[model samples]
Target: MPSESSTLHTPAEARVRPVQQWWALSGRGVAKVFRNGEFVFAFVSPAFLALCFYLPLSALMDVYGVDYAQFLMPIIVLQSVGFAASSAAMRASFDDTEGINTRFRVLPMPLVVPMFARLSTNAVLLVVSLVCAAVACLIIGWRPMGGVVGTIGLFVVALIVGLLLGLLADGIGLMAGSPQATSQALVFPTLILGMASSGFVPVSQFPEWIQPFVRNQPISQFVDVMRAADTGSLTWEILRPTVWWCGGLFIAAVLLLRLGNQKVRA
Candidate 1:
């Protein structure tokens, strides 16, 4: 007669494949975003920013020889991307605080799968946010004059930036002591960076003392490249600073991820 253990299933038999595991978690994340009304905020935020800023400020920008609607599109789109990233941070913090991530640690899956799943969900939201921002821009009289290649480049840059920011935010969520702290930590930096950028006004409009800082900051570099791409005037010189900024963001994200993983292990 066979022993009882011989007839029972092994732990390995019960384990799911890593790919399946990743997809399942990703589906869960995406479903939560939709079910909890995150999609509604995803649509509302860019539209709100576009209407609030464009209507009152278009005439002021026109006086300075700038087309406000067109000029505001990049920053508006970027702000939506920022919102998506912030949402990712909040989700990460919730998962950690709720012990979901801790439960994930005991699962029969690769350690990186959860992170990748979160990334996939973030990507989905990022695209949705971008589309909403584009619609908002259209309503405000912004047109894509960038031609096919330049337009593609414009979105490509936004995606890259958004993903990096999302990763950074993910790390912040993992390491932050609480969800409220994560939200508080993100608020000032986003505001300071967005407002100080060359996105809304000409660099000359900034105080002469701060012009040098405003001209060379990461946000300003991104805006310059985006604006150049919009006009089909993008050149290597205009893109160099953005490349450097991407490299810095990449390094920061990697470091943050490492730190976050350490915290999780602890």
Candidate 2:
């Protein structure tokens, strides 16, 4: 007869142990992030970005009657969200390239388990990035001017945006063929959207020719909503575009994840 320990390794046992598997995999992902020093980068990136923009542009922004510190907070936080999503993509890409995802497929556990574990890891990192971003904003003199409910709303919006972006990035990583390619693919768009958006300066600052694009882009809308939330001035007109953008992101993430899952099964 087969050994008792071997019998415990049957498919039925594996199916029952998905929770354990998810926890273990989540731990592994978190550990890898620490080992690779991404945890440190999570703190450093936001702080660096804040200082880089704040020191040079504060005087100029003040010329426009803007408090640069307050004006700059939303983008810094959003950039941190972007960082978390990029990290998620890299983690997924590494898993794909190293065949770790393939190995998981051979296991008897549900196909969704690994994806959930990765999402858990992404969630942890996203929260850390937001906290660090908050610290950076505080140091630069960004305060919560919107009272208790508004402050909570500010972060709630950020967390929702971060999670959706993370899900989208994870799907992209799985679909990409290589980690280098994944990084390149994400970097250009991130740079373009971030720089082109109203996050850095008022949309009126742009030339009349490009102003329409700058004003109407998704990133600009996100920044506007976040700023309104912080100042207790959010209106339906300001928030409607963001709601639609978020809905679109959700749909895109779901479709990409399904396609990625199919690619793996194939």
- Give candidate 2 regions above 4 Å deviation: 1-16
Per-residue alpha-carbon lDDT of candidate 2 for residues 1-266, written as tens digits (9 for 90 to 100): 99987897886776669989999999999998889998899999999999999999999999999999999999999999999999999988888889998998998778899999999999999999999999999999999988888788888899999999999998999898789998997899999999999999999998989999999888899899889989999999999998999999999999989998898888
lDDT of 1 by residue, 137-247 (tens): 999999998899888889899999999999999999998868999999898899998898798788888899999988999888888888889889999999999999999
Ten-residue region with minimum lDDT total, candidate 1: 7-16
Model 1 TM-score (2 dp):
0.93
* Candidate of highest lDDT: 2
Runs of candidate 1 exceeding 4 Å displacement = 1-16
Q: Give the distance in Å from residue 52's predicted Cα in candidate 2 to where it truly belongs.
A: 0.7
Estimate the TM-score of every prediction: 0.93, 0.94
Worst 10 residues of 2 by lDDT: 7-16
Candidate 1: give the clashing pairs. Answer: none
